[model samples]
Every structure is written in C-alpha cells, then in structure tokens.
Target: MSSLELCYPQLLNWSCRGLECLHSEAVLLYTLFSSIAVITVALNLLVIISISHFRHLQTPPNLLLLALAISDLLVGLLVMPVESMRIIESCWLLGDIMCSLSFFLSFTLTSASVGIIVLISIDRIVAINYPLQYINVCVCRVCVCVCVCWGCSFLYNGLILKDNFSLRDRHCNGECIVVNNYVSEAVDIVVTFIGPCSVIIVLYTRVFTVVVSQTHSMNSHITAGTGCKVKATKSQRKAAGILGIVILVYLFTFCPYYYPSLAGENNLQVLGIVTWLLYLNSCLNQLMYVFLYPWFKKAIKFIATLKILEQNSSHANML
Candidate 1:
C-alpha cells in the first residue's frame, strides 16, 4: 500500500485509509452538515424552552415532548457533529474510547427518542379513549413513564454496546466503525424500531378512527353539560393528528437507516446516507410543531422577543 493509504503509518494495512475529497465537495459537505447540526440544536432548544418556561405548556403531553426535545437536542449537540466528522473524514482521529462512547450516546439517544414517541402515542390514546380519566392518569404517571423511557434507553444501549467498549476485535487505529453481532442487531431492530413502530401505528390507527367518529358525532346537537367534554375531545384530536405527522416523519427517516441491518448488510457507505437522513428527522420535528400548532408559534415569538423573561410570564395562557 502507498504511504497515503494508511490512516496511521505505524498500523500499516490494519489502519483504515484516509478519505480523499475534492476541495469544493469537502467545503459543501461541511457546510451542509454544520447547518443541519445548528438547526437541530436551535429548534429543539426552542421546544425545550417553550415547554419548560411556560406553566400552561407543562401538561403531560408537552412533558413527553420536552423529553423528546432533550434527546433530539443531544443528537444535534453531540451525535451529528461527531458522526459527520467521522463520515466525511473517513477516519477516526479520536481514540477508541471516545469512539465507543460516541456510538453509545448515538444509540441511546435514538432509542430514547423512539421511546418518547411511543409514550406520546400512549398519552394521546388515553386522552382520546379515556378522556375523563386522562387527568388522573397523566399528572404523575406520565412523568414516571418519561423517566423510565430515558433510564431504559441508557441501560439497554450500554448492554448492546458493551463489547465495543471492552474488545478491539472489530476496530483498529483510525477506524471508528462499530460492529454488532447478529443477535444484537436483531434485538436492536426489534426493540428500537419494529416493536415501537408497530405500537405507534396501531395506536395512531385507532386514534384516527375514533377522531373521525367523534367528528361525525359533533354535527349533532349537544347538551350544555356535555359542552366541556366536546371541547376537550376536539383539542385531543388536534394534538393526536399533529403527533401522528411527527411519527410518520420519524418512521420515514429512521426506516432507511435500519435497512442495512434488516438486509443483513453492514457497510459504511450504506450507513452514511441513511444515518444523516435519520438526523434530519430531528430538524423536521420542530418544523412540524411550528406548522401544526399555533401555541408553538406564539411561544417562539415570546421567546425570541424576550417576553418570557418578564415576571409571571410562565402563567401566560399559551393555549
């Protein structure tokens, strides 16, 4: 091999080759990836602030959203930049420990984001199907669910990637790729994608059906006592519809990323495109909220203008 082929001259053939990109193409790639990272962080940060600072926005559904925002924020702030450098440079300059930790965080945040979506689906289901009991169940139980989602994500990814931390069999100098055994890959696909997506689809289908039936029923005259119930149900339906869009976008982006695992092909070239698409989902989510929810727009205005800094601003009626 030529001297330039090796990422580390000392490692010879074992070291991965350095990437060679045309100068113009390299500049474009950096610009694209950097823009994505910035947008992801900024948008998710708006969500985090919107939910955390506003008392009216701290409802159970929004609490789940906050957790999701945090995960996405980490994806932007941590995973995207590192993964971009690793992919574009085509070599790992960082040591093995950093590589392992980066992969661990990527997997954990991804799983947590999916878990949060599942929780949101469940929350919407309960709000629609059991509107009367939603208040009782959501107030404390939903918080517990959010906590469990994050905790499980961390522990589960740790187990799945433990070997990468301890063994160097699949890696060499200047190589940051992670290798997973068949069983582990299968389990990850099932747990992170298959099972959660199935649940979300099923729940959303039911939610849509119920919403349509409810909308049809709304045409009929309603008694005064039932007016409050009707209003709440309408609000719940709207939230469900918006969340459904988010889920659809998420699945669209993530399914491609997992295709290699499903097809039993594990190669870097296949991963690079799909993984960036998956990261793009983070930016899309906030855009969806902006388009679908007026409250988010109002919140953004207040945040941008520093109106939220005022005393008692948390109590401002956002909804």
Candidate 2:
C-alpha cells in the first residue's frame, strides 16, 4: 500500500484515540483553564468599571488603559469560554462560521490591543519630550489613534476571513488555520507580526531616547538650581527603571507568541500560552499604572473611597 493510504488510516486511529483522551481529561483542563479565565475576566472587567466609574481616571493615558481593558475583557468573555469548551470537547463543534468569527475577533482585538500599547508609549514619550506642547497636541489624538488602530485591525483580519471563509470545514479543528492558502498565511505573517512589531519597536526606541534625554536635562537643572542633584538623579533612575520593566514585559510576553507564528508553524499549545500571557498584559497595566504612576494610584484610591462611602450611605438609608 502507498504511504498516503497507510498514513491515512493511522491518522484516523490516532485521532480517535486522542478523542478518547480528550474526553477523559476534558473536565480537568476545563476546570483549571476556566478558573484562570474567570479570574482574568473579572480583573479586566473591574479595570474597565473602575476607570469608567471614576472621573479622575479619565486622563488621556487612562483612556487608553480603559480601551485595553475593554478589549481584554472581550477576549476573556467571548473567546475564552469557547476556547475552554473546545479544550473539553477536543473538536470544533461551533461550525466554520463561528470558527471564522472567533478567529477574526481574536486577531483583530489582539492586534488593536498591541497597537494601543504602542500608542501609549508614544503618548508618554511625546508628553515627556514636549511637556509644554502636551495639552495642545495630546487632546482627542489618542481617541483618533485608537479608532484608526481598531479600524485597520478589523480590516486586516476581515480580509483574511473573506478569503478563507469558504475553505474552512465546520467539522475540522476549532482553531483558525488557513489550510490551503499560502498567500493568506503570508499576509498573516506580514500584517500581524512584522507590521505591528516594527511600529512597537520604533515607538519604544524613540520613547527611551526621549526619556533619557529628559532625565539628563532634569539632572542638569537640579544641579544648577536646587543643589539636589542626588535626589534628581535618583528620580530619573526610578522613572527609567519603570519604563524598562514595562518594555521588557511587553517584549517577553508578546514576541514569543507572534514571532513563532511568523515562522509558519501554528503550534496551538504555544499560541494558547502566549495568548494567556497577553491577556495577563491587560491586567498588568492596572498594576503598572497604579504603582508606577502616582496619578493613577491617586485615582484608584479616590475611587475606592467613593465606593466605600456609597456603600455606607446605602446601608444607612436602608436602616
């Protein structure tokens, strides 16, 4: 018999055996991942709510944070549930339409989220570099940039769906894979990986340069005026340290996920872990903003106090 024929039957047998294993372990993995997913969902949702409910949190950067929270919450709410079910079932039961929709939303939201991070870096750099010009140039610009990022992301992923929707088999795997379209695969590589990654790298590079320059200027000013060069230097170092951590986390979590996909192998396991880590990024932003930036911390504390007061008032009214 030919190798193709020999492999076909073996593939079927292995698939069947895999299905049996999937059934046995489904509940365990589902419980574990579902728990993580639930926590992630709650965290992102809380971020959105906290930011929205608090007026002080409505700064330009916090606005961007709110957008990130929304995207991450959608990922946790819409995508993760289906993903958990798929893990339990070990098969794509939602049909090709849902499969396509899921992939499209996941890709678009993820891309937009990364794009927003890049925008946030740029916003910070500009604010630091041209502090006097910040108000003039910064207002309404972040919103416009966010809209453009989301629109382009949807357009890019929509094209992928348009081209490959008919070819997908409802009975096949739940994951999005362009089975026969090498061109679609190539587009995914360029647009998804190379495009946003290049922008992120360049933006952060500029941001680092601007921050270092500002720190040097501040050090010089403090030395000449306040005679507290030591304190100024320490502050500069602290700012730089925080920015470095943010950049490192972004690269570590996101690069591993997309770089591998660019190389043409869709290792779903790696992809899943990376996706989970990326979702973790949204949650991490709350920590970063609150701890690394004083303004955000103040805003959060104020919101918490307000909530506490509201609860007390409600109890008194009930009494």
Candidate 3:
C-alpha cells in the first residue's frame, strides 16, 4: 500500500490506516460537515442576537431559547469542526488530552441542549395553561433554571467521562473513542434520553390538550372583538403545533443515537449517521424558528441590512 494511505508513514506499525485526508471522499465529507457547522453557527447566532438585541423579544421563553442557542452555538463553533476533522482524518492527531477534552466538551454541550429542550417543553405547558401568569413571569427564575441545567450537564458529562481522562485505557495512539460499559451506557440512556424524553412527551401532551380546549372555547364564544381573541388564539395554537413538530423532529434525530446503548454495543458503525443526525438538530431548531416565527424573520432582516447597528436598535418592535 502507498505510504500516503497511512496516517503516519514513518510510524506505520502503530498508526491507523485510512485513505489520504485530502482524498475525494474525505474532502466531500469535510465540505459537507463544514457547511453544516457553518450553518449551525450562523442560525443559532441569529437566535442569540435576536433574543439579546430586541427588548420586546426578551421574554422568559426566549431566554430559554437564548440558552439553547448558546449551547448549540458552542457545538457548531467548537465541536463540529473538531468532529469533522476526526471524520476526515480517521485518526486522533491532536494528542491524548485533546481527545479527552474534545469528547467531554461535545458530550457536555449535547447534554445541555437536551436539558434545555425539556425546559422548553415545560415552558410551553405554562404558556398554554397559564397564559396570564406566563406573560407576567420573571426571566430571573428562568435564568436560574438555565443555570442549573448547564451546571448539571457539566457534572453529568464529567461523571460519564471520568475514566477517559486517564491515558491507560487508550487502545491506540491514533484512535480516539469513548467507551462506556453496559451499565454506564444504561445510566446515560435513562438520565439523558429516557427521563428527559418522558417529561417532554408528557408536557407536550398536556400542552396540546389545553390548546385543543382553548380552541373549542374560543369557537363557541362568538362576540364583538371575538376575532381579536381568535387572533391571539391562532398564534398560540400555531406555536404549540410548531413546537410539537420540533420535539418530534428532535426525537427522530436523537432516537438512533441511543440505539447502540440500548442494544449494548459500543462499536459505532452507526456513528457517522447518528452522530451527525444529532448535530443536525442544532441547526434544525433555528430553521424551524425561521419558518414559523415572523419575529425571527424580521430579526434576520434587521440583522442582514445592518439596521441592527442603528441607535437604540434593541427597542425596535419585533412584534
């Protein structure tokens, strides 16, 4: 075989074997992943700026979104590029410490995203069932919850990857992989996937039920300015429906990611597809927002035209 096919030709005996990193297939994958990373950064950055810039948009729910966007942004900015390089190279060229830190960072950010999804679900329940109270809600409490969510994510991933920090378990100098025993994998599924997902499913179920009831109530009480109430009701219903779809899409992407754990297999033959599927969700969330939320559309317009740089732009009416 050609020396070009080896990761390190001089150290061929220990180096991992793979096609050249600049090969057509590798370049194509890198391009695709790089595009994904860029889109994820751009979209989530918009969300961050929109929520932070517009005073009218600084609601508690949007705060949650800001938190989610921050997590996703980190994934796109820090995690995706590294993972793409790993895929293109098929070798761990960054050394042992980076291999450990990079995977830990990825896991932490992914876990935070999941936690925020659950919080979003809970937020929707309040928005639908207690609309009056939800509008008057304080962002500080939501900030606390977001903090706890991130803190827990850091703690959780640390525990999960505790063994990885030590170099004793590394199978090869050129390979970077995180291996969890059957029990650890089971625990991860329960904590990150099963538990949070169950809460999301139940919370969304209640949200939909309330939305249905509100729709029926509004339909029956026809009066002057009834259309006004209907207008508000329509937005709520649309938001609830869109959020449901977002949750469904999230489940679709995340389900296969846990398949290896559920099946008790460590080998990630499914890694390339499932890992990126999970990555895709980070970008998908912003896409859904762009599709459904006019505020986001307006935000994009203001941002793209550099209208955001004008004086007192945060006071601009997004609604």
lDDT of 1 by residue, 121-175 (tens): 9888888888778867755777788889989999999999998988864666888
Please give the lDDT score for candidate 3.
Answer: 0.87
The lDDT of model 1 is 0.86
Lowest-lDDT window of 10 residues in candidate 2? Answer: 1-10
Question: Which lDDT values do the candidates have, in the order given?
Answer: 0.86, 0.65, 0.87
Give the per-residue lDDT of model 2 (tens digit) for 1-319.
1111221243453322223334437677787777767776766766676666655556686788788878877877887777666544544546667777777777778788777777777776666566578777643887898899899889877877675577764333433443436777777767766776677677667767766776677766664556565564455456556656777777776777766556765776676677667656655655665567665555455456775257433222110
TM per candidate comes to: 0.93, 0.77, 0.92
Compared with the true structure, what per-residue lDDT tens digits does model 3 show for residues 1-319?
1244556667767667654545777778888999999999999999999999999999888899899999999999999999888766766788878888998999999999999999999988888788888878898999999999999999999988888887524465677888667678778999989998899999888888888888899989878878888898887788789879988988998999988767865564478678889988999999899988889999999999999999999999998
Question: All predictions: root-mean-square deviation over Cα?
Answer: 2.3, 6.4, 2.2
Candidate 1 weakest lDDT stretch, 10 residues: 1-10
Which residue runs does candidate 2 get wrong by more than 4 Å? 1-18, 22-24, 169-180, 221-243, 264-271, 290-319
Q: Which stretch of 10 consecutive residues in model 3 shows the poorest summed lDDT?
A: 1-10
Q: Rate residue 309 of model 3 by lDDT.
A: 99
Model 1: how far is 206 from its true place, Å?
A: 1.2
**Candidate 2 TM-score to native:** 0.77
